[model samples]
Target: MSDPDLLAKLFQGDPRSIARSITKVESGSEGAAELMKAVFPRTGNAIVIGITGAPGAGKSSLVDKLALYYKDQGEKVGIVCIDPSSPFSGGAILGDRIRMATLGMDKNVFIRSMATRGNLGGLSRATVDAVSILDAAGFDKVIVETVGVGQDEVEIVKTADVSVVVLVPGMGDDIQAIKAGIMEIGDVFVINKADREGVIRTQKELEALLGLAHRPDMWMPPIVRTVATESKGIEDLSAAITSYFDFQKAETGALKFWSDALGLENVHTEIVEDQKVRVAMLPIGESRIELLEPTSEDSPISKFLEKRGGGIHHIAVEVDDITASLAKLKSQGMRLIDEEPRIGAEGCLVAFVHPAATNGVLLELVQTND
Candidate 1:
C-alpha cells in the first residue's frame, strides 16, 4: 500500500507528491488503488477539457498554448497527451518529455503522455485514472489531447467536461467535421493556423454545419480562429471554453444529465472491480486432463488413442525462440498445429506442440518473439 501520509499530502495540494502519485498510477503500481481511494473525494473539482482532431492539425501546439494561457490566468493545469502507438513497435512517438517541453518545467503544470496501448478509446483506461488523480490533486483544469479524429478519439470526448474539436485551414475537406461526427461532441471548434488561406471559407462552412445541428440545450458551439504557433486568438479560444462552461451551468437539465451519466460510469467501474475479484478467487486448477477408454466408441479421444495409441501426448512448453525452436522441432519429426507462429494474449508467439511427441499430453508452446 502507498503511504497514506503521502497520498494525504497529494490531496492537500502538494505538487511534488501529486507528480509522484501520477507516476505510480500511470505505471500501474501496486498501491495506486489505495492512493485513488484516498483522492477520489477531492476530485470533481477540476474542469476536464478534451482536445481532439485529425492528424497534422497542430493539436499539440494548441494544447501547449492553451495550457500556458490557463497558467497565465493563475490556474494550475494538468495535461494528458494521447499518442498513437506505432504498429510495428507498439510504442508511442510523441513521448511526454518531448511534447510538453515548455510546460514540463513549471511546478504548477503536470504533463503525461499516454499510448493507445490497443485500448478501444484512443485514450487508455489509465488516462481516465490519471485525470482523476490530477483533478484530486487540485489542478483547476485538466486537458487531454488526442492524436486523431477516429472512433477512439470520439470516445475520449465522452469523458471530458468540455470537448474541443480543432481543424486547420486548407485541409480541402470542409465536410470533414460531419464525416468525423465532430459537430456532435464539440463544445468549441478551433480553426487552428487561421492565418493560412481559405480560413474564411472553412469558418463559413463550419457555421453552416453548426446551423443544421440543433442541440437539445439550445447551445450553439462557437467556432474560434487561432494561429496557435504565434499564440494569437488563444484568449478568444479560452473565452469560448469559459462560455461553454457557463452555458452548461445555466442549463440545469443538461447539467443534471451530464452528472447522472458520470454517476453511472462510477457505478459501472465498481461492478467491474467486484467481478474481477470474484473471478480471481475462484478455485480452478491450472491444467486439466481427460481420459478415454478404448471400449467407448463414441469418444473422440478413442479414435486418437487407437491411431497414436500410447505414442505421445501434446507437450506444452514456453520457449524464447518460437520460429527457430519450431523449425528444430519439425526437423526432429514433430508435427505442428500451425505452420507459422501467431500472437497470443500472454505477450508471446504461440504454437501447438505435436501430440505425438509428448505421450498423449496435448502441448501448447508459448514463446516471446519480441
Candidate 2:
C-alpha cells in the first residue's frame, strides 16, 4: 500500500501494478503521479511506431499482421489502439480490439484500447504516456494505431519515431491526404488490401503527391502494398519499416528532426508536473472546491461575458510550482481569491486567484502530494 513498494512492483513488471498504474493514469487518480514519477526515468528505450489512417482503411488488420510479423521475429510488441468515444455513451467503441482478435491471446502482445473522450489532443497525449509506460516495461517495439485521419489523429501519429499512414484502394479520395495534413508526417505509406481494384491508381496518386511535397529531410517516403487479410506483402511492409528505421538512424538529421518535431520529452515533463501539482493541491474530500468572488464590477466573468461570449464561464490552471507562479501573477497586479494556498482533494494543496487577475479568466493552482 505504500508508495515506494507500489512503484517498485510497477518497475518489476508486475501485471497488477501495471493495470493499477494505467487505471490511475486513465482516471487521473492521486497515486498516478507517484507511479509515473517512478516510472519516468526507465523510459525512452522502445521503438514507438504510430499507425494511422481514415476509418475503414484496414488499419486494425494491418496492425494485427504487423504485430504478428514482429512477434515472429522474436520481438515483444505493445499496441495502443485509439478508438473514438461515443458522445452519448461516453464509452469507447473498442472496434480496434475486435478487429485485432487474433493478437489478443498472445502473451507477448499487449493490446490496450483508448477512447478519445472528446479530447482534441487528449487521446494522443494519453497514448504517448501509455507508450512510455510500455517502453519502460521493456517492450521491444510499441505500435500506436489510431483510427481516422482527423487533426488529432495526425497529431498522435507525429509522436511516433516512424509514422505509417494506411490507405486502401478505391477510396476515391487519396487527395484527402493533403487536406488531412497527413502527407507531411508520414514516414511510410501503406496501401492495405492491395488486391482491391485501383490499387495501382491509389499508389500512383500517392507517389505524385509525395513528389510535390519535397520534404526538407530529403527522405522519400516509400509506399508498401499490403493485403492484410491474406498477410500478403506483410514481409515487404516490415522490410520497408526496417529500412526506414535504419535510414533514420543513419541520417541523424532525420532523427533530430523528428525528436524536435515530437517534443515527447517536454510533453511528458509538462504532464507529469501538471498532474503532480493538481494532485498535491486536492483537499481530503469527495470534491474539492475553491470559490472565487468578483473584486469589481468589471471582474473576469463580467468582462468575459461582455466581450468574449457566454460559454466557458471560467478557467483553472494546474502548476507544479504554485508559489512561484502565483508570486509572478500577484506581482503583475492580479487579484487573488486567497493570499495563500490551502488544502484540496486527495491531499493536494490548492489556491484560486480571481478571474480579474488573469485577463478576465479564473485561474487555479494545484500541487500534488508526491
Candidate 3:
C-alpha cells in the first residue's frame, strides 16, 4: 500500500496485511520494492525448513506432520508449498493439498501454495519473498516444500536454513537421492514410510552413502525414520532439526560479531526491476560494493550464479556522460553489450561492455542522476 504504516501492521502479525504484501511481491507490482526493503530488516526470527525429494516421496505428508508437531508445541507455523504450475494458467496446479485439510483450519497456522511457473529450479522467486513476509509477521517456524522435481531442486539451499531430504524405503529411492546430490545439501535425511517393507535395507544403504560423503562443517547428518501417516518418529525428526539450527545459530553469531567489528554497515537494499535482481549496497570509503541476487531463473544474474558459484559479477565505473562514453567505446572497436544507455537502479543511466572487449572482464558504465 502507498500508506507507510502497512509495514507496521505487517509486523503486528495481521494475516490480511501479510497476504496483501505477499501478493504484491509475487506480481512484482509497483511499490513491491519499497515493501520488501522495509520487510528485510524484520526477518531472521523464523526458522525456514526446506523439504525436497523426488515426486511421490511423501514430502507433503512429512511437511504436514512436522508442522502439526510445531503447532502442538504452542508455536506459529507458516507453510509454503511450491507446486507444479498449470500450463495454461501458470498457477499452482494443486493450490492447496487436501492432505493439509486439518492443519489449514488452525488460525495459528498459515498455508500457501506457489506455482513453479516454469522455473527450472522448482522454486519460484516469489517463494522467498513470501517466506520473508511470514517471518516478519512473527511466524515461529516456516516450512518450504519444494515441487519435488529431483535434480533441479538443489536451488532450495539458497533459501532454506535447514534442508531436509525425504526418501522412501526402497533401493530406487536411494539412487534418486544420489542423482539429486542430496549428500551435499541435505542437513537431515529422512526415510519416510518406515512401515513399508525394505525399510532396514534402505536405512543401511543411506547410512553407507552418508559415511562416504565428507561435509566441510564436519557434522555427520543423522538419518531419521518417519511414518507420516501414523505420525511415527515425528518427535525424533523435530529434535534433529533443532540440533542443526542451534549449531548454525552459534556459527552465525560469531560471523555477525566480526562483521560488526569491521564497521560493515548494510547501507541500502532494493530490488532492481529492470534487471530482475535485488541489490544491497555497502559503502566502503570511496568505493562501494553491490551484492546482486537474481529474482527469477531467466534473470541474467541467475545464469551467472548457475555457471559459477558466488563471486564478483562485474565492475562498474562512473562516467560523466554515458552517451558519449558509449559512442567512444563503439568507435574504439570495443564491443558493447548495451548499445544505448538504459535506466537502471536509482535513476542511473547504465550500459555494459562485453567481456571480449575488456579481456574477459565484464564492465558497466554508470551515470548518476546528479
**Which structure among the candidates has the greatest lDDT?**
3
- lDDT for model 1 comes to 0.70
Candidate 2 lDDT for residue 221 = 90
What lDDT would each prediction earn against the true structure? 0.70, 0.69, 0.78
Per-residue lDDT of model 3, residues 315-339, tens digit only: 9999999999999999999999999
Q: How would you order the candidates by lDDT, starting with the best?
A: 3, 1, 2
Query: Judged by TM-score, which candidate is best?
Result: 3
Off by over 4 Å in 2: 84-101, 104-106, 177-180, 253-370
Candidate 1 shows a clash count of 12
Better of 1 and 3 by TM-score: 3
Tens-digit per-residue lDDT, 47-84, candidate 2: 88988777667777788889998999898788887754
What lDDT score goes with residue 14 in model 2?
59
- What TM-score against the true fold does each predicted structure earn? 0.62, 0.63, 0.65
